[model samples]
Target: MPHAEVDGVRIAYLDEGEGDPILLIHGFASNKQVNWQYPGWVDLLVKDGRRVIALDNRGHGESEKFHDPEAYGAPLMAEDARNLLDYLEIPQADVMGYSMGARIAAFLTLNHPDRVRRAIFSGLGYGMVAGVGDPEPIAVALETDRIQDIRDRTGRAFRAFADQTGSDRQALAACMRSSRQKISEDDVGRIERPVLVAVGTEDEIAGSPHKLADLIPHAEVLEIPGRDHMVAVGDKVHKQGVLAFLNNIDA
Candidate 1:
């Protein structure tokens, strides 16, 4: 429930545990607790001697909300993470993000490689290369009076999830309107640090983890078998794979 002022907005974040730092960025419509805490990520990582830092992207959770579409983008959100790191006086730390947060993590690594050590991108696959899908339907769904009014299945699911999270509908609609920036193949290739691309085998939203792994210079893929996008976040395999990845890295 801690807050940090970044770019004129008060961003809510949770800084917990001890030892080496790991910044956790949650997916769209999810906050630090729902995405990382409820899933036992904080406990698992903390048990492994890691300091966990997670934040609610603008327009979600306890953070300040904005109705302007221009206020939300991968770059701007990534900057919020960077500014949070600055606020904490963390010069460098391991970065991990899920779904939308993964895209934002990529931009953070690309723009401020000096501030990142290893990168973990979860709930993302070839979509990072294929481009973020259309935001119009999702935006419209968020604005609708009822989830049943959303014709698109994905849009309905997102809208319902946002509602369950008690998110600001207008802010989320604006976020959907402006969060379409995609990372290019060239940009992926430019990342020099070790990267882990983790995705569920049944996640249609995430294209292919292998496809994305092939693009990064030093990257590997971890597939959570028999899980989809929604269910994969709390998978035990994901937690183990990440712990092993972190353990194997030379500190």
Candidate 2:
């Protein structure tokens, strides 16, 4: 485990293999290992000769945690990614992010276009612009001690996931409060890097992948058949589609 101090926060990360780098950003309540390593993403990409870099976002995993809502946002976290790249002395790398990580990646690509060669936004779609539902219930669920008391389906799921990951509920509640700033359609259209917007066919939370792809000038879509938001992270078709996208010469 390596640590990089950026924007006054210490972010834990794993940097492995050796080749062209691909930075991996995990979803909410997910650490690098849970989202990328356990899902075989690191192995798959590494075997394909890509140097993999996966980071624990500030409030999750072994990274620094903040209890104040003002301390978190996709743009701020995007800077953490950018500064980590600077710390590693890499000018730019292909970036991939899931769920909340996808939002962070979009901000990174938009704010620092020259620092990203290509990007993959998975587990998120039109939700990036239209919004991903209200965060209040999820944040409240995380703050509640008894899981059985959480009535909102999405909130309960997130609460369970936070507990399973041994996350700081208070910090995560704060993160849930502020990390989900939606990107404007105009801003999304400004991303010049080659981009892939991937989501599961059955995913109810991601809105529509096609709708999002339509907003970006250089974006493509991948629909992981028979998978939903949770299971789609490690789908074989999703992996294959990503590999094909990365290896495409004209992309």
Candidate 3:
């Protein structure tokens, strides 16, 4: 339940274990617990002699809520992550983010490369290069009281997940209406840090992990076979790939 004051908002985060730090960012509508703790990511990283720091993004979990769409863009959200690192006085750490979190992490890596030692982008793919999906339908779904009223399949799924997570519907609506930023091929090519692009083989939302890996200069791809977006979060293949990646970094 610890919180950090960052950029005029209180961000809830978890700091556990001991060793090099790894900042974990959860996906849209998902809190740190559901996305990281429940999936055993905290434990896995901690057991590997690494410290894990995860935050509940703005408008989600116990963090401060903002009804303003201007406050929820990827750049602003990435600043929240950076501010958390600053608050903790962490000079640099490995940053790992999933889904929406991955987009935020990408912004962080692009804007403040010095603060990140390595980057892990999970549940993200060509969407990083191609651009984000439309947000209007999803925004409407968050505002709708009835989940069934959301006609778009993606909107319905996201709305249902938001309900399941007990998120602030209005705040999430604002978030959905905010900016959807995409990294350019030149920008991706400029990143020199070792990067890992992990995605589920069956994740339609992510497009293709290989496509994204091809954009980054020093990046590798890890495909979690037979897993979709939701299921891939806790997949053994993901855990192993991350551990192997970190181990190689230490070597």
- Candidate topping lDDT: 2
Residues 1-251 of candidate 3: C-alpha lDDT, one tens digit per residue: 89999979999999999999999999988999999999899999999999999999999999999999987988899999999999999999999999889989999999999999999999999888886688899989889888767789988988988989999999998988874677888888888889999999999888789988998989999999999987899999999999999999899
**Once superposed on the true structure, which residue ranges of model 3 sit more than 4 Å away at CA?**
none
Clashing pairs in 2: none
| Native-structure RMSD, model 1 | 0.9
Off by over 4 Å in 1: none
Candidate 2 residue-wise lDDT, 17-119, digit = tens: 9999999999998999999999899999999998999999999999999999999999999999999999899899999999999999999999999999999
Q: Tell me how candidate 2 scores on lDDT.
A: 0.94
The clash tally of candidate 1 reads 0
Query: Number of backbone collisions per candidate, in order?
Result: 0, 0, 0
Please provide TM-scores, in order, for all candidate models, with all chains considered together. 0.98, 0.98, 0.98
| Clash pairs (backbone) in predicted model 3 | none
Local distance difference test scores for all models: 0.93, 0.94, 0.92
State the weakest 10-residue window (summed lDDT) of model 3.
176-185
